[model samples]
Target: MKKRIVIFGSFGKVGEAIDRDLKINTNYEIIAPSKYTEEKSKYWSRNNCDYDILNFKEIKKILINLKPNIIINCAAFTNVDLCEEQKAECWKLNTDFVEMLARATAVTNSHLIQFSTDYIFDGLGGPYSEQASPNPINFYGKSKLAAENAIKSIDCKFSIIRTNFLFGYSRIGKKTFVDYVLDNLSQSKPIKVVDSLYSNPILTSDIAKGVRKVIKEAYLGVINFAGNDYVSRYDIAREIAKLQNLDTNLIEKIGINDVEFLANRPIKAGLKNQKALLDLNLKFQNLENSLLEYLTQLKISKESIKEISKNKN
Candidate 1:
C-alpha cells in the first residue's frame, strides 16, 4: 500500500511544486486541497465541510477523515506587511492553525511537515545554521516563530523546514522575485532592487525535491532548506538580466529603506543548508544554475501558452 500524503495550500508555489513532484516523481498517493476546486478530488475543508483552518473542530474532522500518513503544510498568511496590520488574522493561520494541525495529526498518528521563513532571525547575524536562535524583527516572523514553538511544545512527530528568499516560477496570480525582475526587464523597464538585505534564494523545485527526501526518511527535526548561494536582491536581478540577455544597467541598486515596506525585513537572513545536505544528501544549486533552470521553465511556459493559442485559433 502506498503512503497517503496530504498537502495543504496545494495551489501555492511550494504546494504546487510538491504536487508536481509527487505526481511525476514519487509513488505516494497525494490528497491536494485548495481554496477553489482545481480537480475532481473534493478535499477542500470549506467546500467539503464548510470549515477553514482556524476552526479546530472542522480541521480535526478533515484530518480524521483523510488519515494521511504525512501532512505537508504549505499554507500560511505570508503577506509580511499585511501580517503586521492583521495581527489576529495572521496568527490564526500562521500560529493557531499550525497548533490545530499538530493536535489533529497527533491524534491520527501522522507526521506533520511545516514550512517556516528566514525572517525568524534578526539581521544582525545571518546565513544562520539550523541551531541558530531566532530573533524575529517583525510580526510575520513572530507568528511563524510562535507556530514553530507550538509544534515543539507538542509531542507529535513533526518536521520544521525553514527557508528564505524563495524565487522561481509560481502558479498564476503569484509573483516572486524572479517574476518581478523578469517581467520588468523583459519589458525594457528599469528595476530597483535592495542591496542591503541578503538571502539564499532557493528554487521552489529544488526545495520540493529535498522535501521528498525528508518525507521518505521521515526525518524528525529542524532543517534549513535553502540555496547554496548567499546574495542580495540587486545581484540576483543582475544575474537574471545576464541570463535573459537584458541590459545590466537596467537594474538599479538601492537600500532596504527605499522600498518602504510596512514590515521590517531582516538584512542578513540567509539560511545555511549544511544540515540538510549532510543528513538528507541534498545539494542546493547556486544562483547562476538556478536562474538558468528558471529561464528554461519560463521558455517552456511561453511555448505552452503559444501552443494553446494556436490550438484555439
Candidate 2:
C-alpha cells in the first residue's frame, strides 16, 4: 500500500517541488490542501488546496479523518521584517500552529517534516554544524525556534530540515531570491544587496529531494540542508547577473549596519551540508549549474503562460 502524504502549503515553491516529484513516485500518495478549480487548473501551475492552515481546530479535524502517514508543512510567515512588525501573527503561524501539528501528529503516529531557517543562529560565526547553538536575533527566527523547541518537547516523530536563502523557480504570488536578482538586473534597475551576510543558499527542488530521502530512510533529528557554496548575497547577485548577461552595474553592495531593518540579521549563518551530503548521498549542484537550470525553468514557465493565454484567445 502507498503511504499517504499531505502537504500543507502545497502551492508554495517548496511544496510545489515536492508535490510534483512525489506524484511521479509510486510509493507515496500526494494530497494537497488545495486543488485547482476545473477552469483555473488548465492555465495556472500548482492551483491546489483550500483549507485555512491558520485554524488549528480545523487542522485537527482533517488530521483525525485523513490520518496521513507523512505530513510535510511548507507553510509559514517567512517575511523577516514583517515578522518583526507582526509578532503575534508570526507566533500564531510559526509556533502555535506547529505546536498543534506536533501534538496531532503524535496522536496519529504521523511523521512531520518541518522546514526551518538559518536565522535561528547569531551571526558571530558559522558554516555551522547541526550541533551548534541557536540564538535567534529576530522575531522570525525566535518564532521558528519556538516551533522547533515545541516539536522536540512533544512525543511526535519529526525531522526538522533547517536551511537558509532558499532559491528556485518562480510561483504566482511568491518570488525566490533568484527572482529578485533577475528582475532587477534584467531591467537595469539598481538593487542593493548585503555583503556582510553569508549563506549556502539551497534550491527548493533540492530541499524537496532531501525531504523525500528523509522519509524513505526514516532519518531522525535536525538536518542542515543547504547549498554547497558558502558565499555572500552580493556575490550571489553578481553570479546571477553574469549568468543571465544582465547589467552587473545595477547591483550595489551594502553592509549589515547600512540598512534600517526592523529585524536584526545573522551575518554568517551559513550551514554545513556535509551531513546531508553524506547521509542522503546528495550532491548540491554548483552555483553556475543551478543558475543555468533556473534559467531553463524561467523560459519554460514563461512559455507556459503564453500558451495558456493563446489557448484562451
Candidate 3:
C-alpha cells in the first residue's frame, strides 16, 4: 500500500535523479515516462502513462486514472536564449501546463512538487532568501514565475523549489555548465568563461534529496535549494580544470557583455538556502566537493563501460 508518485520529465537530469533516489529510499510506486519513448513502458506500470506531457487530454486522463499521491514536475523549457524567441512554447510548457497540473492535482488531492529557477530575481541584490521578492529578467524566468503563481493561486497543495546552476551527468549527453567546460577543456578547445555573473551550483542528487525532504514534510510555498558557494562561472571552470589536471590557461575570463544572448540574464542569481538548511535539516555540498564527487562517479561509470566492452570483446 505504498503511495504512488508520478514524475514528469523523467529522463531529464533532475527528474532522472529524483526517480533513481526514490527507487532506493522509498517503497512508493514510481512512474517515469520518457517524452518520446515507448521503451519506458517496460519500466513503468500502467500502459497509458506515456511521456507526452504537452498532451493535456493524456495528462488529465493519467491523473484521473492513477490518482497518485504526488506529482513531481521536472519538465521545463530551460534554454534561456531559446525561451526568449519561443515565448508561446515557453508559456505553454512552463505556465499553461503547470496550471493544468495544479488543477488536476487539486482533483486528485495530490501534493505537487514543481522545480523552478533562480533567474526570477533581477540579480540586483542576491543571493536571495525565500522571503525575497521576485523580479524576473528573462522570458524563461517570467514563465516559471508565472507557473509558480498559478500553482499558488490554486487551492492545491504544492511546493516550489528555486535552484540555480545545476550540474550533473546525463546518460543522453545533455550538457550542463560543468559538461561544457570539461568537454571544451579536454579537447584543448579555448573556452571563454563568464566572470561577472555568479551562482551557486548544486548537484542533481542533492536537489533530489531536498525534494524528498519537502515531500516527507509536505512543505507548502517556495524554498531555495542550491549549493553553498557563490562563485563566478569562470571560477567554476577553473576548479574543473584544476580537478582534472587540465590546462587552466585555456580558459579565458569574459564579462556578460561579451556573449550575445537573446534574453537578458541576471548577473547575481545565487540562491540563499538557509530555509532548506534549517527546515529539512540537510547539509548541502559545497561546489568543490560536489564537483569532485561527480567527477569520481563519472570515472567509475567510464570504467564500468570499458569493462563491459572488454568482456564483450
lDDT of 3 by residue, 103-170 (tens): 99999999999999889899998899988899999999999999999999999999999989888766
TM-score of 2: 0.92
lDDT of 3: 0.88
The order of the candidates by TM-score, greatest first, is 3, 1, 2
The residue-by-residue lDDT of candidate 1 on 180-296, one tens digit each, is 898899899998888878999888899899888998899999999889899988889988898889988988888887788999999988999999889999999999998889888
Per-candidate TM-score against the hidden true structure: 0.93, 0.92, 0.95
User: Who wins the lDDT comparison?
Assistant: 3
Model 3 misplacement above 4 A: 38-47
List lDDT for all candidates, in order. 0.86, 0.85, 0.88
Error of 3 at 229 (Å): 0.2
Q: How accurate is candidate 1 locally (lDDT)?
A: 0.86
| Total backbone collisions for each predicted model | 0, 5, 0
Cα lDDT tens digits for candidate 2, 1-313: 9999988766777877887778889888787875455543643455334567887898888887889999888888888999988999999989999999999999899999998889999978987899899999999999999999999999999999998887777455468778888887788889998887888877778888888899999888899988888888898999999988888888888887888988899988888888988888978766777778778877898898899899999
Off by over 4 Å in 2: 34-49, 311-313
Q: Report the lDDT of model 3 for residue 45.
A: 57
- Candidate 2's displacement at residue 123, Å, is 1.2
State how far residue 12 of model 3 sits from its true place (Å).
1.1
